[model samples]
Target: MMQRNVGVVFGGVSPEHEVSIISALQAAAALDRARYRPVPIYIAKDGVWYTGDDRLLDPAAYRDLDRIRREATPVMLDPRSYRTLELVAAGGRRFARPARWSVDVLLLGLHGGPGENGGLQGLCEAFNVPYTGSGILGSALGMDKVLSKMLCRDQQIPIVDFVAFRESDWGYHEEAWLDRCEQELGYPVVVKPARLGSSIGISRAADRAALDAAIEEALRYDEKVVVERAVTALREINCSVLGDVHEAIPSVLEEPVRSAGQELLSFREKYLRGGGADGGKHARRPAKQPAGAEGMASLDRVIPAPLPPEKTAEIQALGVRIFQLFECSGVARIDFLMDGTTGQVYFNEINTIPGSFSFYLWEPTGVSFTDLTHRLIDLALKQHHDKNGRVRTYDVNLLSERSLQGLKGAKQRAG
Candidate 1:
């Protein structure tokens, strides 16, 4: 079998920058060495791109990003070629020549910002390259909390009532917005940056004061903010959906264990305190667990979340529906909020490019990390081919002199 170069792209100018790095590195490490060659395409916090040898694979090497930037060869995507990367400094040296690296497909590990929110996906589409995960519309919808909830609500999918506002909207009518939330959603509500993930700018507000503060904090991260009625007896159940709209399946559910007195899953709890976090190396681990970190997989979670068969089936079915509704390709993790007291589930948010690719959830279902990546790459290639098979462009020369004779301002435009 011929080996394919898989560009594992990650890291971006978002609060989840470090988290994205961890996710990408974990993915690169998991790719089947014999079938695929992983190419490190690291997007720096400053928006520069770089690609290098296996040295970029080491997690510890990221501690000094400045050093990595200096050592790595800067590169950028070639818009003219399909799945090709051109070295930024290709011909800078007198004796050196320009070079391009061709990739079979892109395995996106990006979690937040432009990388995950349709920016990179749109670029890939323009370049005519095969890339994993959702396309432009799906990626955009998945990233926006307000839009996703609205879509779910429109489709009769249960979702907690939420009030969305922009920074400008809140600027002059802060009190009105506060009064609206207090009246409609009640006292306790969860405030989050509409387009961010990894719980970076998320907070649970129990009163008007906290709600006000939470909104302000969230606004610092994003222009738009969403405040949802908080679930008092919240149980976060995440289901991973694999493949595209045509044929997709959900993995076994996972219930992440939250610490006592923790109203929401803190960034520390989700990544730092877990057995697999970079900083949690010395932190105590849950009994019966093996050693080593695995990005989100390192977090302590109960696989096959202790739910009844019917409940599991319902959530899994919902996951697949949402995946298809959003026209998502490759893999995505759809998170849900279940009222432990009422046994009701509500659509929370979807991670189009979930951390660790949510492979741990699939592991229990007989899918290994390598297998998950293989399926994603295969799906990407198939989607690309299917898309190209359609009629995309017209062969008519609409801009020719003969055709432009009747057009107004044609000479001005041409000049």
Candidate 2:
């Protein structure tokens, strides 16, 4: 069997930059060596692109990204090809020239910013290269908390009631906006940067003072901010959906618990909890992961979520419906907020390019990490083929059919 070159695109100018690196590295390491060869594509925080040997896939190597860029070959993806990504790089003063890499498909490991918010996906679409995860529409929609909530509500998908505002709104109508949030959502609302993930700019506000500060803090990260009524008895459940809109299945659910007084899952609790995080205090880890292996799985979580069989099945089915609704391909993790007291579930958000591709969730369902990566590539290829099968351009020569003199005369007459 021929091995396909899979370009694993990771890292971006987002708060979740490190998370992207971890997710991409984990996926690259787990890719099926027999079927696919992983090509590490790193997008620096400053938007520079680089491609190199396996060292780029190491989490430790990224500590000094400036040094890594100096050592790695600067490259760019060719936009004129389909199912064939040409990584073009010219010989420079210091490093030796390297051969161009022909990629069969792209495995996107981007978590936030343009990479996960449809910017990179649009580039792939324009280049006609097969790429994993949600397409432009889904990525853009999923990234916008305000828009996603509206769309889900339109589709009859249950979502928490919330309010959204832009930075400029607070500039003049600060008191008015605050009043609306306090009146509609009441006290104890969750404030978040509209288009960010990984709980980077998220805070729970219990009163007017906290709400004011939380909104201001969230605005620091994004122009738009959303405030949702916080679930008092919140049980955060996340389910991973694989495949595309046509045929996708859900993995077993996982519940992530927040530490006492944490209010919500802060960025600290999510990534900085254990195993080499800032102070080596990472979140709740359910299993002993191998050294250097990291991602969403490293965080504390309860697999299968301790939910009843019927409730688990219901959440899984809902995940599938969401995948199809968003026309998502590849794999995505749909997060839910379940009210422990009422037994009601509400759609919280969608991670189009979930950390580690949410492979850990699938492993319990008999799908290994290698198997999950392989399926994503297959789905990407299929989606690309289907897109190309449709009619794209017209072959008519209008200029040849109409004389310049006749066209001028027609235009003058119409005017």
Candidate 3:
């Protein structure tokens, strides 16, 4: 049984960079040793790419990222073959020989920004590399909060009332935008950067003053911002969907526990809470973790969500429906905001490459983290095969035809 090399891509020029590292490393650690070899492809905050087995695989090495990157090999893609993903070392390496590695599939652990947006997925498409999670279109849709909600609305999927605006619009028509939000969505709104995930740059504003501040804060993270009518009686629920939209299954729902005073899940609450020596007030972890360590699995949550069996089934069905609507492939986690009193479940957002791949949600469904990662790789390969099977290129060259000659003659005459 030859082992397939899996490149785990993470750590990007995003605010969630550290969290992406944790998610990527955890996924790498969970890869079945007998079946796959995990290769760490670390993208630094400055957009430089690095590769080092020791430096990347160990969580502690990231404590001093500058020194770690200095010790690691800077890598770039080999442009020789469009269909092959060959990683070669960049110049100015500490070692005389820079190692080159080949990967069968890419396991994306990126949390937000370009890494989770269509940018990275488009790169993968251009390279003809098989990557786990949603494809370019799905990723773009998932990242754009306004567009995603629009899609849901089109599909008759329930979502919370929201208004979206750009920084330019806010700056120029400040009173107009504020009036719209207040009139359409009202006060007690949730302000968020449209393209970010893991609850970064998300805030709940109760009145006009807080809404003004929240919108400003969110704009610092993204050009486009969304102000959603805050669900005062919000009960957040998340379900992970696996496989392609055509043939997929939903994992058990998990309700993430939020820290006090946090109306919405903050970055610290999502990734750092219950994570360190000081109860994760900061991500200041002790040097070593216990054996069988987990990342997102450590989040304080209730498995099966303590919901009625019927309600659980309903949410799972919606999860699958949304996954299919987005034409998502591989794995994605769809989060829902439920009105606890009314039992109304509204689609919140989708994480195309959810943190830790949402393996915790799958565990109770009889799938281990190892199995989950393996399936994601297998699904990526399947999607790649299907994509290549499509007719993407024209067989005949237009330059060789008489029509082209006529067009050229016409253009020359015009010139």
C-alpha RMSD for every candidate? 3.7, 2.9, 3.2
Tens-place lDDT per residue, model 2, 115-187, is 9999999989988899988899999998999998998899999999999989988888989999999999997
* Model 3, runs deviating above 4 Å: 92-98, 275-294, 401-415
Q: Which candidate leads the pack in TM-score? A: 2
Model 3 whole-model lDDT (C-alpha atoms): 0.82
lDDT of 1 by residue, 362-405 (tens): 87799887788889999988888998999988886768877677
Model 3, 101-180: lDDT tens per residue?
A: 78778888898888888889898998898888888889989989999999999988999999998998899788888889
- The residue pairs found clashing in candidate 1 are 276-293
Task: Please tell me which model should have the higher TM-score, number 1 or number 2.
Answer: 2
Question: Candidate 2 — what's its lDDT?
Answer: 0.84
Whole-model Cα lDDT of every candidate shown, in order:
0.84, 0.84, 0.82
Kindly report which residue pairs in candidate 3 clash with one another. Answer: none
**Candidate 3, residue 220: lDDT:** 91
lDDT over C-alpha atoms for residue 137 of model 2:
95
TM-score winner between candidates 2 and 3:
2
